[model samples]
Target chain A: MKTRIFSLAGIAVLLALCIAAPQMLDAYSLGVALQLLSWIALTQSWVTFSGLTGYVSLGHAVFYGLGAYVMALLWQSAPLWEILLGSGFAGALLALVIGYPALRVSGPYFVILTLGLSEFFKYIVIAVEAGLESSGRLIFGAPDPETLYYIMLLLAVVATLLTWGLARSRWGAGLRAIREDETAAETLGVPVTFLKIAAFVISAFIPGVVGAVWVLRTTYFEPMQLFSPTTSFTIVTMAIIGGSDRAPGPIFGAAFIVLLSELLWARAPHVYLVILGVLLVSFVLFVPKGISGQLAWLMRRRRA
Target chain B: MNLKSIALRAATASAAMLLAATAFAVEPVKVGVGIAQTGMFAPAAIPALNAYKMWADDLNASGGLDVAGTKRPVKLIVYDDQSDFTKDAAIYEKLITDDKVDLLLSPYATPAHFAIVGVLERYKFPMMGSTAASVQLKAVKPGNIWFPTSALPDVMGPELVKLMKAQNIKTVAISTLQSPFAQEVEKYLKMALKDSGIKLLSSVEYAPDIRDMTSIVSKMKSEQPDATFSLSFPGDSVLFMKAAREQGLSAPFQFVLVGPSAAFFSKIFGKNLDGIVTMGHWSPYQTKWPKAMPFFEEYSKRYNETPDYLDVALAYMSCEITQAAVAKVGLDHDKLRKEISSATFDTIDGPVKFDGVSNASTPTMFLQNQEGKPQIIWPASDATSTFQKKGPWAN
Candidate 1:
C-alpha cells in the first residue's frame, strides 16, 4: 500500500512536471529549478551518511567534485548516461576504499579525518590531471539544456527513491542506533563499522551521480566548482535542519535552505550564512530532533 | 553488401538518437555565456550579466546578429556555474558540444575565466574574455582563442613609469591586497619601477579582507612617499579610504586600482573621492565618436547608472568589435576572429585595435580620478581634461 502511494505520488509529480514545463517554464526557469533539485538530491544523500550515523563530514564535495571530473573525463570518451552511472559507481568505490581507514576513527576524530581525507584526495587525485586539458569544457561539452533537465529530474527521483528505501530498511534502524548510542548498537551485533562504511558509500553514490548530472545540466565544471566546501556544508545543513533520520527531513530542509538563501541573496549576500549559523545553534540547543521531529511532535499533540 | 548496409544502419540509428534527444539542427546562430553566477566571481559576474542583457536586447532590437546567409536572431543561453571549477569546466564543454552555440560569451573573474578559457582553447572557439589582467591568457605567445579585456598589470609597470616621468613625479609608495590577482600587479609594477628613477618609499600588502587598515595607512604616512599606488577591491577599498581619511593620512597623489572608481565610486564616496586616480578603460571627455554617445544614453537609461572606465571601454568596445567581426567574416569561426583582431573599431576609448599577443588595444588612456570623478587624461593625444594635480601631485 505504501509503495502504491509512493508510486502514485511520484507519477503525479512527474506528470505535473511534464504537463507544466512546456506551458509555464521558460528555458531559464527550468534551468534554475533543475539546479535547485540537483542540490536537494545532493543534500538528501548527505543525510544517509552523516545525519543517520552521526558521522559529520565537512568534505563531501571531494566526492561530488571527483564524481563530476571523472564523469567529465568519461563524457569525452563516452555518452551522458554512461558518465552518470560511472560517476555514481566511482563515488561508491572511493567511499568504500576511504571508509575503511575513515571508520577506524570514532567520535569527533572521525569527522576531522573524513574532512582531511576529502581535501587530500582532491589535491592528489583530481587536480593532478586537470591541467592536462585546461581550456574550455576540456572536451565536446555544452549539453542541450532540455536533455540535462530531464536527466536531473530522473536523478532527483532516483535519489529520493534510494533515500526512501534506506528509511524503511533494517539498516536504517541500525544507523539510528549508531547515532544514538554507538556502544549499545555495537553490542547488539549491528556490525557498526561495516554499517557506517556502507552508509557513507551509499550516501556518496547519489551525490557523485548528481554532481555529474549537475555538470551536464549547467554544462560546466572546474576544480573549485566540484570540491567547494559550500556544496558539502549546504547539503549537511539541509539534512540537519529538516530532520536527519526521516525521509521528509532532508527534503524540507533542502527546500527551506535553498529558498531562504535565495531570498537572503537578493537582499545582501553572506548574511544568509549568519542566519544558518543561528538556526543550527537554536536547533541544537532547543529542538534537538530537528524540523520534521517538531512537526511529528505537533501532530502527536493534535491527536491527543 | 551486408557490411555496407550494417554501417549505414548504425549511422542512421545514431542520427535517430540525436534527433529524439535534442535536435542539433543548427538553424539560429547560438551564443553561449559562461559567467560564474554563484561563486566568488558573483560581483564581477553581475555587471557582466547586465552588459550582456543590454547587448542581447540591443541585438534583438536591431533584428539580431547577422549571419552570412540567414539573419538568424541571436540567443544567449546563460548557465549558472555555481562557482565549482569542475562544474564550470563541465558547463563550457556541454555548451560547445551540445548546445552548439556559435559564439561563447567570455566569463568574468581571472581564475574562473582562465580555467574556462582552456575549454575555448581546447575547442578553438574565439572567446573574448573580461577576466582581469592575466599573462596566462596570451602569455608571451598568442592563441586565437585568447582575448582579455583589461591591460595586463605587466603593462602597468611600463605605463606608470612613463606617466611618472612625463609628470616629473618620483618616489612612490605602493600597497596591494594579499590576493593572487593583486599580487600579480605588485610583482610586475615593482619591476617597472626599477627602470625609473622613482625611489621606492615603501610598499605594503594587506590581507584580502582586512578588518582595520589604519595601521597600514599610518605606516605608509610615516614613510612619506611622494605618491601612493594602492590596489584594493569594493569592500576593502572603501574601508581603506574611510580609514585613511579618518586617520588624516592622505597621500597627495594616490593611484587606486581595482577599487571603486567612476559611477560606483562616485555614487558611494562623492567628493571624498577627489584626488584619486585609476587606470581606466574609457573617457567620455576623450572620445568624440558618434556611436559612443548612443551607447552612453542607452546604457544610462537602461541601468539608470553612468558607465565606468571598463564598462564603456572594454565591455562596450568588445561588444562592438565582436559584432563587427562576425559581420565582416560570416561565422566561419576561422576567419571571424582574425578579422576581429585586425579590424579597427572606433571605440569609446578611441580607434581601438587588438594587439593579438596581449589582447589589449594600444593608445589606451590612463584615467584620472579628479574630485570623485573619472576623466581620461593620459596619452595627451586623447586628453580632454588636462590633469590638474591638487593634493599629493601638487607642487
Candidate 2:
C-alpha cells in the first residue's frame, strides 16, 4: 500500500514536469527532450514484449516504419487524430500477422525472421514510392514544436504506465512462465502462443503511435530513414542496457544513451558510435542485470 | 565648484568614452553550415566545408562583409550531420534556434538537402545550395531555397545530348546507381535522347553499395556503343573505371560525372585520362570570370594544393550571394530574402540570376582531360581546347 502511494506520487511529479517542460526550456533543449522521449517510448514498447516474454525482437522497426508511412499517406486526407489511431491499428494488425508465423520459431531463428521482416518492408515501401513516381511524402504545414513535444511526452508516459500495469497482471505471469519454460507452461494450460501474440500486438501499438507523431513533427522522411535495421538493433540495445527485466529499466537506459549521444554528437561526431559501442560492451560485461536490476540487488543486500 | 566638480567631470568623461567605444563596435555576421562530415557523404561534404571556411577567413581578413555602410566580420558555425537526414534536421534546427546564425548554407547531397528544405521554409531562412543539383527539388517549390550550382539534371541532360550529337556519337550506353537522384538523371537523359539521332544501346542500374561493377560493365561492353556515360558517386566512379580497364572495354568517348572532381582520379589514371569528357562548374585555368583567378590563387596559396574548382566556386558563390543580399537589406530576413529573389550577382561562375523559385540556371561546362589536366572542350566559346576525336584506348 505504501509503495503504491509512493509510485503514484512519483508519477504525478513526472507528469507535472513534462507538462511544464516546453515553457521552461529553450527550443534546443526542447528538441533534445523530444528525442529523449522518442527513445524512451521506443524502448519501453520494445521491452513490453521482449522483457516479460523473453523474446528479443530485431524487427520492431517495421511497425514504426509502417506507422510513419500510414501517417504520411493519410495526413492530407484524414483528421490528425484518425491518422494517429490508424497508425496504431496498422501496427497491431501487422504484428498479429507476422508474429503468428514468426513466433513459431524460437531462439536465433525468431531474431533473424524479425530482422528480415524489417528489410522486406523497407524494400516494399521503396518500390511503392518508386512506382508512384514520388520521392517521398512531405508535410507542408506542421503544428508548432511545443504541441508535438506534448504529444510525444504523453505517449511516452502512457507506454511507461501500461508496461508497469501489464507487469503485475495475471497475463504477465503467464508470459513470464512461458519465457521460463514454454513446454512446461503449455502442459499447465497456460495458452503460451496466445499470450505471446497478445504481448507482441500490444508492444507494437505504442511504437506505431509514436512513429506517427514523430512523422508529424519531422514533416518529412523516406523509407530508409524510418525502416533501417539499425533502428531495430538500437531499440533492442537500449532496452537490454537499461535492464529489460524491469519496467523502469528501459527508461533509464534510453535516457543515458540519448543524453550521451547528444553530448558526443556536438563534440566528437565521428567517434560517437565508437564510444557508444565501447560503453555497451562495458555494460554487458560488468552490469549484466542492468542499472535498475543492480540497484534492486543492492537494496535487497542492505535489507539482509 | 571645487575639487569635487573636477572629479565628477572626469568620471562623466570616462563613462562617455566607454559608451562611444561600445557604440562603434561591430557584431559579426554568423553563417551556419550543417553538413555530412563523416559517413558516406564525407568525401564530397568535407571539401565543401573547407571551402566555406576558407571563404569566411578571407572575408574576415579583408575587414569583413560589407553590410550597408559598416563592415561586420563573418563567423562560420559548423556541425557534422553524419550524412543522416533525421540528424541533419535536428542539427539544422539547433543552428537556427541555438546558434542563431544570420545566414544558412545548404548541406552536401540531395537527400540531406531535401530533408532540411521544410525546416528552412518554416524558419524563413534563405539557403544557397552548393552541392545539391536535383531536378526533383523543383517539385517542392519552396521559395526560400536557392540552388547556385550548375543547371540541374533536366537542363544538363539536353546539354549532354547536344554535345553527343555534335561529336557524331551514334550509340550510347548509360549506367547509374539505383538511387532517386540517379533515377532522375536517367529519366532526364532518356527524355533528352528521344527523337535524337543517337540511340541508347543499354541503360543499367545497380544498387547503391554494390562493390562489383564487372557484370554491369560487361553488359555495357557487350552493347559496343560508341560512347558510355557512368553517372555515379566518387567511389563507385573509381571502381567502374578500374573495372572497365581490367575488362579491356573502351569507347571512343567516355563521360563520367564524379571522378574528375577529385585529384585522386588524375593520380590513378595519369595520362590514361586523356580524351575522357566530364562535367565541371569551374576550373582554375579558366580566366573568363573576373573572380576566378583571385579565388583560385588565394585558395591554392592558403591550402597549399590545387583545389577542386567546382567545390570552391560553389562555396564562394554562396557567400557572395549572402553578402550581396545582406548588404542590400541590412539584416532584415524578409527584406533580405526579397533582395536575394530579385537580384543578380556576379560570382566566380559569372552572372547568376535566380528564377521564380530561386534556382539559378547556371551553365554546365564540359571538359576533356588532356595530359593529366582538365581543359574546357565544349560550347566553342568556353573551350580552352578542342574535343579529341578519339581516346587513346579507343579500338
lDDT of 2 by residue, B56-96 (tens): 88888887877776788898999988877777667888999
Point to the candidate with the largest TM-score. 2
- On a 0 to 1 DockQ scale, where is model 2? 0.41
TM-score of chain B of 2: 0.89
For model 2 the local lDDT of residue B364 reads 69
Interface RMSD of 1: 8.6
Chain A fold similarity by TM-score, each prediction: 0.88, 0.96
Over 4 Å off, model 2: A302-304, B1-24, B141-143, B271-273, B378-381, B389-395
Clashes of each: 39, 0
Q: Write the per-residue lDDT of candidate 1 for residues A1-304, one digit (tens) a residue.
A: 7757986999799658754673577543555566667776787788777777887887678778778877767776776678888898888999999888888877889878877887677555433432242322333344655666777667676677777787778988898899899999999999998888898898888888887876654444545446666677777777778887776787678777767865674345446568879988888788777788899899779979
Candidate with top lDDT is 2
